[model samples]
Target chain A: MAKTIKVRARAKDGVVTVKMLISHPMESGRRKNKKTGKLIPAHFIQEVVTEHNGNKVLVANWSGAISKNPYLSFKFKGGAAGDSLKISWVDNQGKSDSTTAKIK
Target chain B: MNTKRRLFLKGSMAAGAAGVAMSAGLLTPGMVLAAWNEGAFKAKSVDEALSALMGSSSTEAGKIKIKAPDIAENGAVVPVTVSTDMGGVDTIAILASNNPTPLTSSYELGEGALPYVSTRIKMGKTGKVIAVVKSGGKLYSASKEVKVTIGGCGG
Candidate 1:
């Protein structure tokens, strides 16, 4: 599987700001296919977890109401430059992806 | 008196079982996420969703700030930011009152994280975007109404 997640973490004044973008359809299962005229299945992400320096920082539960190609940004404390940050997400269809970035 | 004793025993037994389960690593995040808040996500109204998600619909107005455009040009992707400076905040939940599924997302912040989240959500129509923050076990909420030029959910 290709890398479906893009993440960046930067540290400033002992605070780390993390931004991530996940590539997913985020289909609400309510929209109809323009060609098939059939309802699209709901295939959005359900869980997102972020870790800083191997410590769990945040866990987000999401629904199909989120926009396609979701973007999320958050902040944390006690992080420094050169620390590792990891982000992972799982969709309703049982598919998942993760990425690791360094705090700069 | 007998009924009360039996209930107490049952509660203690359940607590013991849960402790064992946690010690045995049976309650990992992967296992828990498999059972996402289905009832809350499927609820059509804000009250139903709130009660389903947090078991309470009552919230006190607080200093939670919701920063979003007054008018969203594209309902499909309306940017929103919910933040608060209150201490001991552990959870943040976002809801769109008019969407088919009123609850859009809920975030659990750990000890190292701050009480802030920024993301984009879909709005079916013009409605209030509510941010509910759980701090010190109390729920605080703030909302902003955003006018949508076009509906997002494709009917």
Candidate 2:
């Protein structure tokens, strides 16, 4: 199934601090099968982008060591109440999901 | 008749001794309690963990603010922060949606302290990160997805 993400942002004093969490299995290929003793294929998200008021503010790149359902937090400049922040992510399998939050 | 009475007395003594042993720490309360706790903590899934921690089957959204990267370069140390503007927030918890044990950590906020926390966690791969907050005797949650480039769990 495609990953799901949620974003929450608050704007204050010309800066917006955003918080987000995403759902995914994040299976590392290193895990061995108990039945057949074979390695699992590596699957993970690779990149994330956050934009405030349609302007890019923060970006993050991830490796497999990250636990499943990764959590991220950052701040951006110049967003106000009623402004929208957009967040998008791309996984290793080329799957992507994006969501937006209105500043409150 | 004397032998019969003596044998009856010995049998009664053995029964009394056995009863005393039963009450005198022969059956440890600690072991039973430990086993119960292990079962309690054995959540095979994220939803199960949440239910166990919050004592509720469902959690509402919008009372908590969970922050994490949309993409992490290193899964070993992805930073996470949780904050709440809602008044009377008592606790905040972080859960990895795809982790074997999804409930990563929980923090209890005191009355005087601010209702916010930040920490780093390990990620197995790309997945959703959830934050649940308890306030006014209710549970609320939020989630975001993060992408991992390199395997943090030695993949």
Candidate 3:
């Protein structure tokens, strides 16, 4: 499958700022299908983890209230250029995807 | 050809088992992944959601900083950033007071991670965007009312 995550990590003054956009519907289970008139089942990212050089830096838990195609940005200290950063997410339906990026 | 086909079947079985384990809560990838507060996310009120996520909903106000728009043209995607300078920050949670399910996102910061988070959340209508920060084993919070011209959440 094609990667569902896009990440950008930049190191500045010992801090690595990471921004990521994940492709997901984030259906809240409250919206109804326009034609079918049936509520859409809730399917959203439940957990997102970020690792910096094999060390867990941030872990986020999200509800369906998050916007579709969620965007998250965070930062961590003590990171340098060329370090590997990994971002992954697990959805409510047990779907998961991960991608690794290098700090610039 | 038989050997290659056997390898394919073995790989698929492993993948299927992983999917089942993940859905059954038997395979938690990370320690923090178990912190997904289902009760908190399903809570209808802000206080209830907070209490479910944290032990208590009571918080010291004016310490955390919440950066969001005062007026949101689109409630479906309101950008919010919560940050604090307080040391020993453990967690950060964001909530939309007027949404059906108030809690939107919660974060646990690991060592070396800053006490900050930014994301976009949905709002059913004009409501207060609350940011609660847990630092030094205490909860501190700040909120800003965001006026919404169009309601989100399909309401």
Candidate 4:
């Protein structure tokens, strides 16, 4: 599966800042289908987790209110150049994906 | 509005939608409601939802820095960042006061995680964007009012 998540981690002044974008529909289920005129089922990433060098850094519980292709960013303590940073997300439908990046 | 009353009203509204879905044979009511956090979303008051999310009504006053634009051109997407120097921060939750579902989302930070978070959220109207930080088993919060505008018409 193509990694729908894109991540970038940069270490500056002993702090690691991570930013990411995930591709997903994030349908709210309240909107009607243009053709069928029927309500669409809600589909969105419900959980996101970020890790740094094998240690958990941040975790989020999200919902459909998040716009499609959600963008998230955060900073953490103690990240060195070449440190591994990973981000993963799971959708309401149980589908999941992950991506990894190296701190610059 | 009280938390329980608002929840009940919202639940009724959801049930109405589910009724339509059921009659149309589109889906089971439970299936539709199962995907989201009904309690947090239905909450009509910030304190109501925060208490439920943070597991307490009492919060200690602490330093919580919230960064957001004073004005938003589009209500569809508004950028907000929350960060704090507080130690042992465990969770960060964002709430947009005035949105039907005030609680946008909450982050649970594990041991050794940072106390910063950023994201974009939707707003239906001009209101306060609140950020709640949980640290050392206590909740602290700060909020900033963002004026939402539509086509240059500020609301």
Candidate 5:
């Protein structure tokens, strides 16, 4: 597991806007080791979901072609200030991480 | 000079002029240098690359939004997206502030396409994730801090 996942949500006109960033390497397995010349194994996040107040707002599918440190932002309907937004993700290695954000 | 002599001289002069002009355009030093430097998409950092692509520094924040995970378990495959509500949005760029090459990717929005993009990326460590949007010839940027728990590069 990486560090703490942080999410920030702001509500305006009954819409909740959320911003998030996940820490990952997104290795493509195409890189070679300098010493043994062995190809690195492929590892990257596969999917992500953002739910605002129990409603799905954004769903993303990713691949190894992405660069390092993936970030995303989106908006959903009907969330007031102080409501919570849940974000979850799964990686290629079968590891999963989730975090929550309070509407501000 | 006689008619034949004049005609021969004119023909030789025209041929020589054509050959010289052709070589001048095809083999000039400037032309060779231009050809060698054709690709101008290289950038050393996120800021430099964004400035180069947008022709200006980006604003702090406006209508653009960037989303990602707070703590990414892996660095190689972090998902990212940028969405904006502004009209006339021309381009969007994602930057990892702490990566070796921070400028991850950029997208040019088509006329009728949605002004949003989603992609994955790798991270070396915890850093600010930036999204820069180009609209109406001005650049706007927003960033969020992402914490990396496990090492993404090698760990």
Candidate 6:
């Protein structure tokens, strides 16, 4: 599966700033399909994890209440240019995907 | 608040309860995903939701900062950012008080992760956007009100 997360990491003054935008339906399960008249199955990102140089830096927990295509940003101490940062997420339905970015 | 927005918020809360029920039996066997905190998302009241998620009541801390718009043009997408200098922060959770499911999202920070988070959440109407930070085995919180105008029909 193609993960919908776009990640950017930049090292500035010894700290790394990481930002990402995830693409997904984030269906709340309450919204019904207009044609079939059936509740759309809930399929939202339940967890997100970010790793830097093999060290876990950030993790997020989410629910269907979040808006479609969630946006996440954060900063952390101690990262250098050319370092690698990986971001990944697992949806409620057990689907998962990941991507990596090189710090600028 | 607009009557339609109020009605939608109510509907969300009811659906939130149903969302909890769905998770109970929805997960397939041998699933790789971790279990969710159904109690917090399903709780009707903000206090209840917070305690359920954090496992205890939180104190208002001065080190926390929350940034959000005083007036939102759209309830469907409102940007929120939370940052804190508290040490050993474990998780950052955001809640929209007037939404059917008051708890919106949470972030877990490890030793290397910064004590900051930013995200966009959907709100049902006018409400306070709250940020709760857990550090040193305690929870702290900050909040600000946001008025959401839908298609210029709101006050």
Best candidate per TM-score, number? 3
> Which parts of model 4 are misplaced by more than 4 Å?
A34-37, B1-38, B41-44, B151-155
Off by over 4 Å in 3: B1-35
Give candidate 1 regions above 4 Å deviation.
B1-35
Best by DockQ: 3
Candidate 6 per-residue C-alpha lDDT over B23-83 given as tens digits, one digit per residue, 9 for 90 to 100 = 8656641263435677887787788888888988656665788899999988767889999
Q: What is the CA-based DockQ of model 4?
A: 0.32
TM-score of every model? 0.86, 0.47, 0.87, 0.78, 0.49, 0.82
| Candidate 4 overall lDDT versus native | 0.78
lDDT of each: 0.91, 0.67, 0.90, 0.78, 0.67, 0.82
Report clash pairs, candidate 6. none
| Candidate with the larger TM-score of 5 and 6 | 6
- Give interface RMSD, every candidate, in order: 2.5, 15.0, 2.5, 5.0, 12.3, 4.1
Clash totals for all candidate models: 0, 45, 0, 0, 37, 0
Candidate 5: how close is chain B to the reference, as a TM-score?
0.69
How would you encode candidate 5's per-residue C-alpha lDDT over A1-104 as one tens digit per residue?
A: 66535677788887666666777776756567888888878666555666665665555545454765566655555678988778787666666689887899
Chain A TM-score for predicted structure 3: 0.97
Query: Candidate 6 residues A56-89, lDDT tens each?
Result: 8887888777778989999988788998888888
The candidates, ranked best first by DockQ, are 3, 1, 6, 4, 5, 2
DockQ (C-alpha based) per candidate is: 0.48, 0.06, 0.54, 0.32, 0.09, 0.38
Better model by DockQ: candidate 2 vs candidate 6 = 6
Colliding pairs, model 3: none
Please give, for residues B6-115, the per-residue lDDT of candidate 3 as tens digits. 99999999999999977767555344345678889999998999999998999998477888999999988999999888999979999999999999999999989999
TM-score of 6: 0.82
